[model samples]
Target: MADGIDQLPVVRTITCSHPSHAGYEKDFSEFWTGAPDSKLTNRGDTKKWNGGFRGRPALADALWPELRNYLIGRKPSIFNNAITALRAFWRFLDGYERYGMEPISQLSDISTSLSILWLNPIDEMWSAHSRQAHEIIGVLVRNARKREKMQSAWAWHPYPRAESTESKELPTEGQIRTAMHLLKQSAYGIYARWKRADAMAAEGKNLLTVSRSRQGERNQKGQLKRAFDFELTEADAHATYRAFIASSGNPLPSMADLFVALGLNGKDYPPWWPTYSQDHPQAGQVVR
Candidate 1:
């Protein structure tokens, strides 16, 4: 991300066409069957009008007639993004339909003066719906004007450019479940570390002098290292830190002094021991 990482495993949802081939579909059946098909079918002879548009009754009656022109020569990828934006724009307008629908009618008639809808999207990248819908409307009106031997309307850009969009749909249930499972595993790992600290404190009497018999340990990067010759326990160092508080009477404490008090040889410490010890805070002078 240019800003920062929002979530891992970049995932998205895609929208597909659904058939409403019963009501207004009949009125536009010929249009769908007529020509160079949409990018959805790779513009093949096979005809369809992307999930049939149930154009509002008597409103924007010319939209269905000019839809084929909108789909003509559109790239499939661009078409998908356009359709997705349209769907999002459509849902977004329901709340303000009184201010919206008229733009469709004006698509085929400049004389049909009406205000265009203001689409305020949450994510700026999703603002493409305005341009996409406007361009499609321009195609419809310009062609309709041509048929009547009238001057075509200028295809003016209505909104600023935004990043390409796929769809505005949220993540699916499967994606949520996968994230939850990974998070649970991470939580367990943290719990295990805390348990290890507790166990070391409880069994401080049986501390290990050398850990040569134990398995090799892994570092933060998961790299395996040679088995340690000495094991450091958290309890003693934690105790040392509480008592290691330096004062005017007591000089500052070094980790070297911490090691001697704990009765452990520094040479026997593993590569990871320095980091581990700092976290546990070993002390040599603080002991006897």
Candidate 2:
């Protein structure tokens, strides 16, 4: 008869969680999207908003808690570094999904059987966090019954720990030449803009306005036919009256007639100026 044998029973040794690993919260999936704005502040455990660890709420829930618990009370530095490293691993998993392979539902799903996948392509390390990625997975999934007995899960370690390449990487001649050409062009553009601004500032023209005074701006008398912007405040009105009294006579009847002979270009002014000037022409008329 063909086998009537049932699958063998399994027993686990490590608890994968310890009493000492008790400081941080289990669910940090909220840190993925609406980060600091999501009512949770970064207090030694969670990080602030970042593009890392985004768009996978379910995977984040499954993995982040165990990772956080792995080094919660022990080493804050490694925990922070692992945040970045783990995100790279998550992106790797995304690639794993795109290939139409069986998706990993949990941390333990990454068995040692898949070790060859990490080694075959030399450039695969570009998407991973190097050796630290192994350490991150090992620490997160290894939950011993007791704190002292805890060890990294062997399933993840042997893979990303591949040896370094034989030779050093260097830029090619073409790459160097193109880089130099681009830098030179950028410098020339910056110098041209700086010289233009310097020339504009030299002429009594407002450097920000970037316009020079033209021949059309000058009247027949050769005077600059520009509008004089004078705003009268309480202090200014008082100062004008004081200047008039001290000199024995103000040249203008009121502040109103000051701009009357020199007409406004349909601009707004205090209504009282025109009112005072219109009401009494000879009231305060004086010598030039």
lDDT of each: 0.38, 0.39
lDDT tens readout by residue for model 1, 1-288? 111212323222222222322121112322212212133546565444432222222223444445444544544555454445444433333323332322332333342111122233322222224566655554555566555554311222244456687888887899977875665455344334434443444444222233343356666654346444555445543334323321111223455554444453433343434234344343332222
TM-score to native of every candidate shown: 0.26, 0.33
Name the best candidate (by lDDT): 2
Question: In lDDT terms, how accurate is model 2?
Answer: 0.39
Any runs in candidate 2 off by more than 4 Å, and if so which? Answer: 1-27, 30-65, 115-126, 144-154, 157-288
- Tens digits of per-residue lDDT, candidate 2, 13-56, equal 11214355545433333323312212334565543532332244
Model 1 alpha-carbon miss at residue 82, Å: 4.7
The local distance difference test score of model 1 is 0.38
Residue pairs clashing, model 2: 15-143, 15-144, 15-145, 16-143, 16-144
Q: Which parts of model 1 have CA positions greater than 4 angstroms off?
A: 1-60, 73-75, 85-93, 99-116, 119-134, 145-157, 161-288
lDDT of residue 85 for candidate 1: 43
